[model samples]
Target chain A: MSTKTETRKEEIIRIAAKLFKQKGYSAVTMRDLAKTMGIKAASLYNHIESKQAILQDVILTIAEEFTLGMASIQNQKASSTEQLKALIQLHVRIACHNPDGLAALNSDWMHLEDKLEYYLQLRNDYEANFRHIIERGIENKEIKNVDIEVILFSMLSTLRTLYLWIPKKDRLSEDELSASLTKILIEGINT
Target chain B: MSTKTETRKEEIIRIAAKLFKQKGYSAVTMRDLAKTMGIKAASLYNHIESKQAILQDVILTIAEEFTLGMASIQNQKASSTEQLKALIQLHVRIACHNPDGLAALNSDWMHLEDKLEYYLQLRNDYEANFRHIIERGIENKEIKNVDIEVILFSMLSTLRTLYLWIPKKDRLSEDELSASLTKILIEGINT
Candidate 1:
């Protein structure tokens, strides 16, 4: 594709993510997307294949980014605590940059037609790798002896929903947000 | 209403909550709901007024339960730690009893036409009451000196999403789940 074509495709995906985030994936049609972009549906087809294709691109791209981030964190020699903090920072940065895309990645991935299995594989792999790190932490006495699933679930649930909460705030920088989350999530709130 | 009429209404609302949990509120029609219950659409009207009314009933019923739970916790003369544990137990028990209803309360409340403002008011008040307890904990030095919002957000996010996770498990009793969550959430997982 030409540079102009690629740029338009990117813009279409961006706007589609926003629409999908608001009205959900099943409710937003190609015409709705085109209307939001101030273009005819035919013009939309010129840049994108279909609404499902746009969803596939939006969700898989973010999912792959997370997989790559996890791989990078896992290959490091840092302690589990450091790696977990890096993971929190990773989520904060991604959520800060593309809250809408993150929302789609979380909520609309189920709507990916042909790519659903690939998405679920990546999700399960990402989660397994996360659990491995928590297991290592427990073994090394760097974390508590709580049920690994419980700790993992608590942290993942918070991290997964950051897009809903973080975009509403303007006071905290990314670093401040990550630090506060790391402290509250990693360390107990007990005095 | 006669006992038989009341029982039929409850049965329709129960089945509607299940369908709403699966397909979401907008996608589930009154006809679809009646179909799920093995009845005609006309019979559905005898028990319920409209799809919106059923959604209003499902969501408001669960929302009011949470509100009442929070009120009871607030009235107790317990310490923050004790109050927080009671709050977790309350969520676990509620989610255990009505996972589909809780799911609707979380995801489908936005589709509410007439009761939107009232639902939001109840939600905002619940969160405010929760924050008040955390603020008091911080003031009394019973909890860590983290950002109140961060602590609140971390805990609330997990508690709110429990309906998605808890229903998949069959081994742990409500008391066990509540205790595990309290330990991980309140005490932090740091060894």
Candidate 2:
């Protein structure tokens, strides 16, 4: 695509992400997106084929980032604890950096039917990566013997909620929050 | 209220919940609600003062149910572990029976602003009840020494996702699923 075409596509996707995150998928109209983007309603058709496609692209971008974050950790030969810390840090960082895409991925895409089914599979696949780390930790007796699925679900859910709870200005510096969260995850608040 | 008035209010709340849950809050108009109820649009104003009042009443009902669920556990005399189990069970029950309310409480009401702040506070206070159970568990040595905040966040997040994960029909009965989830949460899958 030409530079102009690529930029327009990015702009559409960006605006769509913000709208979908803020207003929700079902409620946002294509005309609304066009109006927000300062383009004719018909002009949007030239760049993006459908609303679902826009949603798919926004969600796929987030899924890719999450998978990439996990893959980078897996590629390294870190111990289970180190891998888990890396996973949490990367997840929260992506969440804070891209709240719109993150929220769309985590909350809004369920409205997308078949497109969402594809996203769900990708999410499960990514989750399997985390489960693998937790399984390894359990095997090594490094972490507590929690049900892998429940613990994995709990950890992922908690991490996803940072999008809702962590205000942009008040978010603890990444390094400090990572150190604190990592310590809590690996060791219970016992002593 | 008279029996007729009570029935009318429930009917309105039910229709509103369906519309809000499926179509979203902003998209569902009073006309739509009236149409769904098989009544004239203006007729709704008699039963509920306004759309906002309907929203408030629906939210207040859900919040009340949440508090009642929390109280059911709070009223019990048991170990912190037992309280945690009750808390999980109540959460799962509410999520199953009240998926719309769960989503609204978790995601939808961000748009409702100060109007819904009262509802938000009720839910938060209910959550604090759950958090206190975890805190007591840590004090009593029932739970592992994990960061109480992270663990609390994790458990609540995991529970919230039940609205998404639980199927309408399955081999696992609600009781069985709730029991399994409670177990997985209290005892990590080590042994």
Candidate 3:
């Protein structure tokens, strides 16, 4: 979503996500958010209830998007390799558009307070779905005879850290990254 | 090195690394260290000069290990694939034996004050050497025709996060983990 089209609350959540990325969720305050926006704390409070509210919005929105993306891929009638590519694209899309939010999701998701369990549930379900796809692929001989957790861990680590790499690497466009990553990740680097 | 052979200062550094992983390097106090060690703060000081000393030992020790690992790999007359597998094994060995130290190396290396520049120089050289090896592989038509940075980033990401995953994954032995990771990371997951 672009800044011009965002609602007041959406604007606050977006900016707060950046702040949470810069200063951890626990360290950020209402005044900090307000100062970043060039507004008074009272005005900031008008749109968001508290720092916790913004964190939930910042993290949960992206988490739900990932969950929904997984579901959408399942709805497609595609092979396991195609599904995996789609999954990579989903991450690339989110990471490209919402890098700051991705940072907060990685760094400050622990500070979700009462919502931690639900966030973890979403994450667990997401990984479960990812694992099931890989498992099915292995059973069907689409994937190689490899350890499932190793495959999952290796892929997830790279995808999770894409936020860190995406900024410093300005030459590679999102599509280039998606293609190169898919090739390097899905197709072995072996000649 | 095992606990039996470690000196008192080495024990403090090892325990401090665990503390740094649990509570970040900046948050841990000398008092907390003494309490955890079941000794007085004055006694703790007899072994280490300050928190900075412990932090430096915890992080730089691992950093230097990685640098030295890379150097040892260069001394071998091996192909790029062999070198890469050795690198993966190197990460697995360090992670399995010193998981806490790896965490400190990953998370607390930024707080290394005067030594930070040297630390970064070591990391940059390590990565440059890694990149050069892959580049040589590509030029020799041994490695797949893939983007060097993408391959580098993907492999480094997984190898770097071994500390977080090692403790939870008790079923896989060190050699098994190293072999599976070597295969999955180098050969890709495709059938």
Candidate 4:
């Protein structure tokens, strides 16, 4: 694809993610996407195939970003604690940059028809990679000996929902968020 | 209402909450609720007013439970950490006992019609109560002097979504979950 066409596709994906966040995936139609873009429906088809295409593009793009982020973190030489902080920062940065896309990825991923299994695979692999990090931490005594599930669930729950919280808290500098979450999540709130 | 009628109404609400969790508030109907309960629509009405009533009942009951739980915790003479642990236990217990209703409240509370503002007030008041606890904790040096929103958001995000995680983790006993989460959520995860 030409650069201009690729940019238009990216723009369409961006706007569609916002709309999907507002009105859910099932409720949005091609006509709505066209209207939102101020283009004819035919032009939208020029850039994207269907609403499903946009859904896949929006969701898979973020999902792949996470996959790539995790791969990089895995290749790092940091301790598990520092690795976890890096993971937290990864989520915060993504959520800060593309909360609407993240929101769409969260709420509308289930609506993906063909790519559903692939999406779930990416999610499961991500979690397994995360779990391995925690396991390594436990073995090395970097993390406290606790039910790994409890720690995993608590951290994943908070991290997964960052999109919902970050928008409400834009005043928090990204550095502040990354640092504070590192302490609050890893260090326990107790002084 | 008579005792028998009240019991039946409770049954309807319970089933409806389960359905709402599976589907969603907008997709659920009185007809669907009746079908789930193995009763005709007309008979369902004898016990309840409308779909709005069921939603209000399910959500308010859980919301008010948190309100009451917070009130009871506030009445106690304990440290902020203890109070926060009590709050965590309160959420775990509620999520363990009524995961479905809690799920409905988390996701479908926005669909509430007549009671939306009241729900918001209850929610705001609840958050205010929580924030004050954190503020007190920070003042007394029981908690670290981090951004209150970061602590509050991290903790509340986990607590709010317990309903999603508990069912998958029914193997974790209620007492175990409460204690482990207190450690993981409050006590940082590091050694």
Candidate 5:
């Protein structure tokens, strides 16, 4: 694609993410996206192939970014505690950057027709890698001997929903948010 | 309403909750709901007024249940730690009983046209009560002096998303699930 074409495509994806986050994937139509963009629906088609294409672009890009972040963290020499902190920071930063896209990535990935399996694979792999880090934490005595699945589930639940919370909390810097989350999540609040 | 009418209305609501959870409130039409229930769309109107009515029923009912649960817990003489555990169990049990309704409550409450503001008030009140409990814990030194918002956010995020995880682990009883969550959430996992 030409530079202008690519820029327009990105703009379309951004607006579509906002709509998908608001009305959900199945409810958002190409015309709705075009209306939001102040472009004619026919003009939208000139830039993007289909509504599904917009969703695929919005979700896969964020999913891949997460996968890559996890991979990079996995290769580091940090302890599991540090590794988990890095993971939390990754989620917070990404969520702060594009909460609308993250919302689509969370709620609309199932709507990916041709790319459903690919998205699921990335999600499963990302989760598996997260669980591995927790398991290693237990083995290294960095974390308690709790049920691995419970710890994983609790942590993942909070991390996955960061996008919903980040937009409401615009005052906290990324580092401040990450540190607060790390302190609460990694270390229990019990005195 | 007569007992028979009430029963049929509830049945319609139950079936509608399932459809809403699967396809979301916006995507599931009255026809789709009626088809799922093996009834004519007109008959669906006999039981429930509209798709918005079904969503309002599903979400408002669950939200009210949480509100009531929190109210009862608030009157307890228990410590903050004990009260928080009760809150967790409340969420787990409610999610277990009506995972589909809970899913609708979480995701599709935005579609609760007439009841939207009421729902938002209930949600905000519920969070305020939760934060009050956490603040009490910090004051009593039951919980560490972490960011109250962070603790509240982390705990609520996990508790709110329990419906998404409960179905996959049917073997763990509600008590077991609640206990595991309490351990990881209230106590730090660090050794």
Candidate 6:
């Protein structure tokens, strides 16, 4: 695609991400997106082929971003504890900055029709990175060896849910929040 | 209310919970709920005042049950660790039994109107019990002193998410699942 065409596709994808996050996938329509962008429905077709196409692009973009972020941590030379901290920080940062994309992944993931197979695979891979870290931590004696699946699930699920309780205004600043959560995850309250 | 009236109310709540879980609150209508229940829309009013009423009841009932279950644990002679295990087990058991109610709380909770302040308060009290256990555990050197917010959030969100992942034919019984999760939460994988 030409530079101009690529830029337009990017803009369309951004708007669709916002709408999908707020109204859900099934509730949003091609016309609604166009109206928000001050254009006609046919004009949107010039930018993207269909609403599902927009959804596919948006979801793929988010997954790709997450995979890239997590991969960067996995390649690091730190201890498992530091690596886990980095993963948590990166995830929370993405959630803080990319609320639209986060919402799409959390709320609109089920609307992908038959294409969910690919997305689910990507999600499993993403989860596997976390699982690998926990396993390494246990092997290295950094974390307990209680059930690996449960520990991994708790860390990921807890981090993901920050989106629900985090207030737009009063949320912990990146450093403070990460510091607090990391301490809790690593050392229990016993002493 | 008479026994028949109570039975009718329970029936209406059950139907509404199913519809709300399947279609979400905004998409479900009284007519649709009535049709699903094999009753007319007007006939629904004989048992419940409004769709919101039914929703409020469903959520409140779950919240109340959770609180009562936790209270019973508090009254028991178990150690802090055992109490925590019982709490986790009870939560998974409820999720298994009332998957629809759990789904409703997960997805359709924001749709409840202003009249549900009492139910929301009940939720706060229920959460307080979880927090209390963690606090007590911390003081007694039974649990870690990590952020109660993070630990509590992880426990509830992870268990609640069982709605999406837990299958009926799973080899692990609910108690087994809870036992594994509790082990992970209270003890890290360091060993």
- Top-scoring candidate (lDDT): 4
> What DockQ does model 5 achieve?
0.70
Q: State each model's CA lDDT, in order.
A: 0.89, 0.75, 0.90, 0.92, 0.88, 0.77
Tell me the TM-score that candidate 5 gets on chain A alone: 0.94
i-RMS, each model, one decimal: 0.9, 4.3, 0.8, 0.7, 1.1, 2.7
Error of 2 at B33 (Å): 2.6
Against the native chain B, each candidate's TM-score is 0.95, 0.86, 0.97, 0.96, 0.94, 0.85
Judge the docking of candidate 3 as incorrect, acceptable, medium or high. high
Candidates sorted by TM-score, descending order? 3, 4, 1, 5, 6, 2
Q: Which prediction has more favorable lDDT, 3 or 6?
A: 3
Q: Tell me how much of the true interface, by contacts, candidate 6 captures.
A: 0.49
TM-score attained by model 6: 0.75
Residue B12 C-alpha lDDT in model 6: 76
Compared to the true structure, candidate 5 yields what TM-score?
A: 0.86
Per-residue lDDT of candidate 4, residues B140-185 (tens digit): 9999999999999999999998888888887889999999999998
Q: What fraction of the real A-B contacts shows up in model 1?
A: 0.83
Q: Which pairs, if any, clash in model 1? A: A188-B188
lDDT of 4 at B146: 92
- Local distance difference test, candidate 3: 0.90
Top of the candidates by DockQ: 4
The alpha-carbon lDDT assigned to residue B132 of candidate 2 equals: 90
Candidate 1: residue A79 Cα off by (Å): 2.0
Worst 10-residue stretch by lDDT in candidate 5 chain A?
Answer: A1-10
A19-81 in candidate 1: lDDT tens per residue? 999988989999999999899999998888999999999988889999999999999999999
For lDDT, candidate 1 versus 4, the one ahead is 4
What is the Cα-based TM-score of model 1?
0.91
lDDT of 6: 0.77
Compose the digit string of candidate 3's lDDT tens values, residues B32-98. Answer: 9999989999999888899998988888888899999999998899999899999999999999999
The number of clashing residue pairs in each candidate reads 1, 11, 0, 3, 2, 10
Which candidate order results from sorting by lDDT in descending order? 4, 3, 1, 5, 6, 2
